[model samples]
Target: MKTHTLLTVQEATALINAGKVMALAGDEALLRQLPKGNWIAGTIPYFIADEGGVESRERLYASELTQVGAADVEIKTYTLDTIKNIAADGPDNGYTIVILPARSAIHTEYANHGRDYEGMFIKPIVGWIAGVHLDDLNRAAPKVVDGSAGAVLAAEAVAMHVTLSADKMAVIHILNLFRQDPDADVITFAETGFSASTCLVNGKPAVLAEYLAAKRIDLKLPLVADYNGAQINTSFQGVDPDGRTVHFYAPVFPGIEYRQAAPVGDYVAELGALADGAHGGVQFSCNCILNYLYGELQGRKTGDLYGPATFGEVAYQLLNQTLVYLDVRSVS
Candidate 1:
């Protein structure tokens, strides 16, 4: 397993300059200094490392991909349409690092179909959405790099798909603390859609106003859907009063019913439990920004787990308030 680390600009520069395949997270200014190579990067200032949680603009959170017995690695860039063919043509056993600018049309598009691509993926993929500080989230757009050109402020996404050795295989998984609030009212929708701002409840297709009015629901607690035993989360962002629509941080997939998640308790302990089980094989990982704020993770350690705290996490699909990770193991 590869361990992630915090690096100084000079240190990171030396590594990238040496042809390392790195996934970077940090403030905008420092990420631009590295010489372009086999790497990808995103903007964010929060992380949970061996040193515990901390936010910084001067340093970078880096995950070295060239480790874990990768005999060869290839880095590539793509627009939304171009990326659709990755699995048909990419390495048979590997992982892709995806970094998309928040709120872009491509971001919205990918959020809806990330899983649809999974069927075509010859390799596993684990990635996240780039983000700015909470205060500048709406004002500052996130950035991504492909190394062929100068670091770019992405209008869409910049992905690095790596090809590992034949003896090694990439594996992807997610860890979620949220569970369905069984005690809460069962909410059902009539229509099928993705990224829906409004949906019918008990045959009434109004906004969340009525639902919010009747139930003592916590907006911070996301809607959870069980997919093949995996708890996928979608969070409530806000509502449009005029349109009677409710916005979501991630898409609510068509035809899948969802239930409000129960509030999480003792996140540090829960994180500890998750890390204890998964830390050994994790090569790349990212946690949701919501977990950091809602769990009060700053200045706390999640065992040996380390990675950026992103706006959204991707593990075959866009997810909210979850931790996603990738690992590679020898076939023999």
Candidate 2:
């Protein structure tokens, strides 16, 4: 049986009818046409299909979850108030996959403070933010569907908890190609948010957007923060009309030192090389939309690391311009 790929609505329904627990991604209309079954999904028209990046309102990307969902699986929804219970409510020995509409209350809440949620980072958690067609940004709404309950949600999040056998374990992996340049000016913020006006550049107070302009910093590059050895990125969205405020796809936390990422060539190749040693281990994976556009991933490949190109990536917490994946392994 296939693990993941683009499937027609009829084909997906066949899998659903077979009692295959899964994760799905597609257009809102197509997703709404799916039959009730063991699955959870979010909306998105862009995907890194086996053939490469493509956008389609007719087909869906499906990842079979029978292995992880084999032992015991549960599908549920969470409102903004109940979203905090996500990590703590998962199976004791399994992992959780979640989806939330882009810019929804639950999405904003989880992206801003999900790291501090109870039981976070204790178990592997991975998912993507749902999004509408690029042209429908203002008119259309993003949604997540609870296939088992046949419920579609716009303001809420849907999560699937998959309990594996005692001998197996689930793990989350992040592939971030961007890293802080050693000599770049260090930038710090006074508050955490998706946008900032004032920030400290090399320890001197300065307007963030003005400083970036003065330094001729390429907005295509992201701000990188090092957590121990892990390099987390906060991608640039745009500068406000005032040119003093800078917006980011992900929030920048206060008290963290950040620097512009170093330049790199060939993101598609780099992404594949980064996951070279983990080929078959990746059971599910998703890339960021910024990468698809900025890196020009259309019609390119990332080896076995593929899925939808989402608005944002999530691995325990929100991430920008990165790839998030789930891998299951036997207990050593």
Candidate 3:
């Protein structure tokens, strides 16, 4: 079973120094004081703890693996092309936790080459890009920890790649409440890039602003794409008036056509259903910040699911407006 705990900076430092495989979420200042050890961390003020939804800047949320869990983790740090190199060699057959700074150039680079990176690595990854509130977006930057090499501030991504032993295996998946509205007009794009502001609607290049206006769709509702079996989301952030382009929390990939997803009717029931059988053996999990606000998760519980409400979640590739979790179980 996964053990989620709340600790102060000093308490968390002790655990880190004692060699624990931990995933941390808290304020930048609190996390910065932590001692370097076997762990990875992200910045976020919102979380769904064992209790309920709450926001804190003082207490640190930590998920520490036991001795059995510790033995299964091979923590490592990657930067720039190094991530590609590790992925190229094929990481150990298990789940990889990728925690990187939000909105950094490196973040953009990885987003742009997500598919290639996914193809190179043959393991399930469940993590999120670290981020702060929109108010902090301009004043503060996202931070990540490379425990092996101490704390890294700005542009770098720290991955706590867990390679489970033969006896134990990992099951990584996502819980997306959004699905395509088949009746909605199909939206396609010709450009192959991330952070797309303009897309082609029925083969005609049009600004996203005009398209959303014409369709009368809510920007809060993300554009969904079915990637083979997995349903991925591209969430809207806002529009740039001067540029007349739409911005997204996660990049909209090329070639794959996207459609606006339908809104969730019942947040509690849907979230509960999604996490129905995931209570046990769940190792790591996180929901999108968008879900927190849109779902009105404050003071509400979703079964036994809990973790930081991140800006963007990662289930192999960067995703938006979804709940991503990892389940590791032992073979009989």
Task: Using TM-score, give the best candidate's number.
Answer: 2
Candidate 3 backbone collisions, by pair? none
Best-to-worst order by TM-score is: 2, 3, 1
Ranking by lDDT: 2, 3, 1
For candidate 1, write residues 1-332 as lDDT tens digits. 23389888998888877767678889888888878776778889998877788888888998987443324666666677766655554566677777888787677878776666644544666789998988887678888776646657667577766777678787887888889877755455654333354555545565565576567668888988877777788887766665456778887765776788987778788876786664445678898888888778898887666799998997766788888888878788
lDDT of 2: 0.89
* lDDT scores in order: 0.75, 0.89, 0.77
**How do the residues 1-332 of candidate 3 rate in per-residue lDDT, one tens digit apiece?**
33676678888888888777888988888877887677889898889877667788988888775424556666666677666644543346676778878988778877767658744436777788898866787899888877666766677777766766778777777888989888766787766555566778767878878778777889878999988867788988877776577788877766888889987788867886786673557778888889888878878877677889897888877889888888778868
lDDT of 2 by residue, 215-307 (tens): 999988899999999999999999989778888988999999999999989877887787556445566789999988887878877766779
How much is 5 displaced in model 3, in angstroms?
A: 2.9
Candidate 2: worst-modelled 10 consecutive residues by lDDT: 274-283
Q: Using Cα atoms with residue i matched to residue i, what is each candidate's TM-score against the true structure? A: 0.91, 0.97, 0.92
- Which model scores highest in lDDT? 2
Write the number of the candidate with greater TM-score, choosing between 1 and 2.
2
For model 2, name the residue pairs that clash: none
